[model samples]
Target: MKKVLATTMATLLFGLSFPVNTFALPDNDVSANSQVLEKVSLPNGGDSSQSEAGADNKAKEDTIAKKIEGKLEAKDITVWQNDTVNWKDGVKLKEDNAEFKNYLEEASVTDLDNRNTNNSNTDTNDDRAFKGKLKITFKDKSVIEIADQKLYVTSKMTNINNSKAPKNAVDVKLQLGEGVKDSNGTIGQKDNPVEYGSYRIKPGVNILNEEHPQIKNSLFNLVKLQVSDPEKYVDPQWSSGSANKKDFVVSKDNNIFTATASKLFTMTFKFVGYDRDSRKSIEFDKLPQAIKDKLPQEQKIKEGEAFEPNKFEDTIKENSGEIKYEWKFKDWNPTKSVSVSENKNFEGIWTRSKIEENPNPEVKPGPGKEEDKKERPEKENKPKDNSKAEDKKEIPEKENKPKDNSKAEDKKEKPQEENKPKDNSRVEDNKNNKKSNNTFPRIKSNENKSSSNKVYTRTSTKETKKESKTENLSKTPKYTLTINSGEYEVLINGQVIKRQMDVKPLIKNDRLMLPLRSLAEMIGAKVEWDPQTRTAIFTNKGLVAKIQIDGNEIVLSNGKVIKMDSKPLNINGRILLPISNVANVFGLTNGNTKDGIDQNIEWDGDNKTVEINLNK
Candidate 1:
């Protein structure tokens, strides 16, 4: 039966005038008719099918060589960061998978589908594979190649093994996402590359999965790209640590772009100093070395990492050689502790001590004056007389006075001179007293005046001594707070404040709020709570503020009602006020970036600390 079928098939083929080599034979079939047909199809009975196949291949190569060359030519392919591309996509070919297979079938000499299974020793291009080098030139003037995968059907054109395309697309993309690269390879319309941005990569396609192995992770600048505009721009600096450029690669030549997708992102934290009053930047170099050493160092933290700012003294005594004052560190402008998602700067707010003349000026002693002061007791002792017999002391000398007979007779005859109130005698007595005591003349008639002078001298000396004591008492006390287990303890000038409470600091709407009574009293403010109204009245530095629990409006003594970003909270019978809001009324400030108001509330949220600068 098989022989008859073979003969009948040959006869039919012959009748149609079909060439024997034109129709291939089944490898499994072998019969007498087939052998005869084979001989008739070729001269000299040679294996002519191979030659015929070679002829057909030669003809096909001639017809489609230009198309193949075009495919080999570099194409300008724009792909999103971390997106993958195949040979077809790289050549800017519009053909789909089916269309690409058809093209290969028409151009290829051998059966490409069975070539792998049959293991034929055929030329690589003849088996429907891409040939020739794909040179990829990048913006940085670097060059690379797309490794040949031996089959052009679905092989990825990337820089994985030997190819020179970037291991990550971000290394070459002008922007982060989808966009058209102009002829000059610029991504956006901006004149500068730094301002360039791109649209987000199409979701579900570029996502890292089994289907898309080229994309290692999500792109970094997705948010920046989404909010970009022609006028508004996002910085495209790939090296600020937003994206990892270690294994980045990209190349474009002739129009071909070969890039793989990989980029990692992380956020950074830095400490900056700012003037609390002016809200101006303070040069870190200008800060005292002591303060600089105490500040938190800059650090790089990945997203969702735990970050806590270190603590610093609220008031630091600073000396500028010629002057002495203090730099009071305040709370950060924005926040102290944050969950890192973007680049953040935790600026330290500071207030300078008020410049004032020294209350007690030193009276520098002169050389002679110092000696005189030392010898004052000796000189005073020398003037002390032992005898209390006032009259006997001087009367003995006056008893024998002026016994001249002739002078006495003249005085008796001139009764007018004798009756002249004895002025001469008193004058001589006073002159003798002055010589003995080295004293200013006393008015014998005004005894109260002399006594009052002595009292005034003593009073003035006492007052001076009292003022010195008062100055010592007026020194501002330093405070340190320790918060743990939702409770806090205070150390004022190294002495515990003795007031303890179980209240934790609250963060609401990005603003820090705390218990008012402790902070107010520490800063020398008197706090009074009204149970009926749930209000706290604060009196400090001549300003009064009445704040109600769970309310945003603050009624000040000056008759102004100000609304706060966050209201006062009542937690566990303790009233907590928004420190940033009421900082002003209590002679404190927690600087406002929007209003340009600098603050002096020394708060470190990371350590759960609040420092009071009484001097401010």
Candidate 2:
């Protein structure tokens, strides 16, 4: 049994790494194959801090680490020679593999500098949020390819490594293609099939999966790539002919792309849709001559049910004015969706929204568009440093009072400020006990809230000294809660918040946990986490209301009520709000339309004056 297993290991792994034809072991010699297996090395799998990489890449490598690191398949993880962090490709260290054993043991340490200092994007003083794109490259070869193109990706850096370079080793959860055979030779997906078999490694004969992917297929879709070399591997301009790189011309036959490389040299081949290499090949469904003619001469991509185009509307307002744009749908894929074309009518919206027109060099806090580490508020406790609430944000007229000095005098004129009931009315709320300070997080709004729906804008204050608690505050606070609306840019007073997430202080399992809804408030969103369904649903006034994690459907609300569209997507055990929709919903608009240092809002039945600045 050991001999059989050893032979299987060599036949499987060695054929993938290094040169497949360098060694010699006859087909009948079981012992020789075992020797080859003995030579196969696994990675150290230890934290990047302990790895041989330099100092900067160690710290935050884990915190910044992407989902890829979790897919490794080795016993002890270790680093590789290419300076690539270990496990990025799912390779782990083995107790054996003495040939490279020293790499893990002798690995250097990355003593990280604990200073929040960066000349590039760092402003320890002003406190800014950063959105960086990371693209992972394997020996400079593309791992997950799509859009008729061979792509390269960079995983988010884990904070484990202390080195300057973002560290966190990468991991690849390599799985067999849709129709490929597994170890037990089952011939189906999620089921192991292929009973261990022996093959000569002389021809570098790598196994092909149902998708016609070669061994350790570099084109897996486990992680999305940010940038890639499209000229060589992209699909044909259409689907029926050859791709001409000169004029960026293409054929309609683009479906799958294959890459062949040797150290410095690389080449990509395009496959047609419905080609012989498709997952359909596993079924051998007899096809008509027309269908046969449509397939390419090589491997084909797994045909999908065409892209479902959803309608979208973008509205933007500036110091200048407001503009609205509508978009139509044809067939939209990820690559094509972001890439605006001449035929696509996004320019009108882009120009009006000022995304292209008014470019801000300084990055704002909150999430970045699409994947990677989204923009988040610098969790730093700023803005709350100076000034009191009423001083900065004068209450809206309805909440405060219009030009009526009479109302301002009433709130203050009461030499008896002590007798005023902390009041059940929100400083924004219905007559209920909802503390604008408690339930409202800074995005979509709070969801843990049992059915009551209300959004309030509150300021954040840090405690330098602790005092006796009051009836207004339920308990001694661990973290302050603040809620802001995306209607216009939210402000505690007149200060613009870098983070838009609503921060809620709650007692969960006895310990306080800040939920996504509160976090959403800071960034902007009314988030609801459903324990019954293990899902999170986010809603906003006129943006896309989406269900995530377990969201099976998405609903877009132009300005109406809640609704569902397509099935929600599950990602990283957490649901992701659709980028465009979520951003739009949580985004703040200018609140005060009238004149202002602060607008006059009337409160107390139009008797009080609250200064409301629409959008600060």
Candidate 3:
């Protein structure tokens, strides 16, 4: 029966193309021909028709078994889901490749109960859902053992297909099973089969598990990201869901991410005014419409919670008059310029007092201009006569009068009576004396000399006393300052002022910045601050000095500008200036004391004290 079946199969397969000469040959010839045919027979069995038939059946059975086996090629199999798998043409199988059979024998499957609706299960055996342990050898020669994963083999007839997969390439889809763990205990989730092309697989077990586990939740998001080089930038995306916040998480190994955040700060302008009805101060957000209309729209400072200093001027000009506003920080007027910054509140108050009219109205020269001018010359010259009279009073009468024996005698006898009223007898005597020719000349000279002497003596005595008093005052010294470093207490002459400093003296750029008010007062310099210009003016002993905040130049009364190494600073409601520079400008000498033991501006670092002795 097997012989008949083999013959029928052959005829069906080959279409009966065999020659009939073998049957017609003699027995010896047939034996010889049979031996030759035996050499070309299939290897399943021997030359006998029965054995040949059995071999053909066995071969057919093997082919059918391979189709149902569902053995996967161990190549680029991925154990994790959501990973990209590359495909390429695979190596062809050879009969002599014994190593491939050993690899297949080692591969075992774990049955997975779940079925993917998108693709049909290649494994039809209901008893065993496919599961496997495959040893994958990577190009780096490292090996990994993957377990608890289902393996599916796909051919052209199988339902599995990928448009991106290489043509003519046999693919293996690796379906990860729940509770599937690698040798390293990496858990796997149920996912669609990861398809890999034939080129990626080897005949043996291919490890689908990656060496390093997939890191999740390792992405951070920035609300806004900025980079200097946009060409080399890469947009960051979250691992699972959309970024919900302006913050991101980074991996422990990768700790650096560059980004810039958008932020805003507020500046508040608080306008304060005195309410006449309430007799109390009021803070308002809006100015009166009348006041607002008078002000230039661009120059008008809007009363609001947020304001810009640069947009408004220190003083607003109106058609009626100019209104000056003061920025009140601690004082009614701050010495420094207004600086707007984050969350800073600036308080301002408009001047409430009416503008004063000029007390002396200007007189314009008009129809009476010529007569007024003529009177002005006479009025101007009148002071010259008074000045001459004042100068004449300084001379002593004794120096101006001619000394004569009679007068000397008279002065001695009537010293007390001389200044007293000369009675009617002296007048009659002068009249009689003027009547004599030669006697009148001498008598007239004596009378005139006595009259001039009396007037000069009275004025000279009073003027001499006034000059002596002024000389005494000029000999006395003005105020003096004695400073000790690191101590706020300073001695103004003999009086010690304690707690006068807001910020302690600081040394910046090898220069000392001290409180301007205290230093200027001690040196007899008047200090005044100009808010509009942001300048501090110091006047002492006919020398004027102007130090502007953040200005590097100091102007002097002599029209000389001194360039300084550092600008003036405002600290804690006080203007601070370079002490040495100010001292030099004010003509304060820097030298040692009389005893030569201590310097004038001495710095004791050990005690953190600065001792400054003026005029010592």
Q: State each model's CA lDDT, in order.
A: 0.45, 0.28, 0.41
Top-scoring candidate (TM-score): 3
Winner by lDDT between candidate 3 and candidate 1: 1
Residue-level lDDT of model 2, residues 394-423, one tens digit each, is 444546656555655564434244332222
lDDT of 1 by residue, 270-325 (tens): 44454423335567777777667666656655443334456455777777777665
Better TM-score candidate (1, 2): 1
Native-referenced Cα lDDT, model 3 = 0.41
The runs of at least 3 residues in candidate 3 whose Cα sits more than 4 Å from the true structure, single-residue gaps closed, are 1-266, 272-307, 313-342, 349-354, 361-397, 400-616
What TM-score does structure 1 among the candidates reach? 0.24
Worst ten in a row by lDDT for model 2? 344-353
lDDT of model 3, residue 571? 70
Residue-level lDDT of model 3, residues 268-326, one tens digit each, is: 44455543222245455444444433332222221222233433434332233364322
1 against 2, candidate with superior lDDT? 1
lDDT of 3 at 506: 78
lDDT of 1 at 73: 29
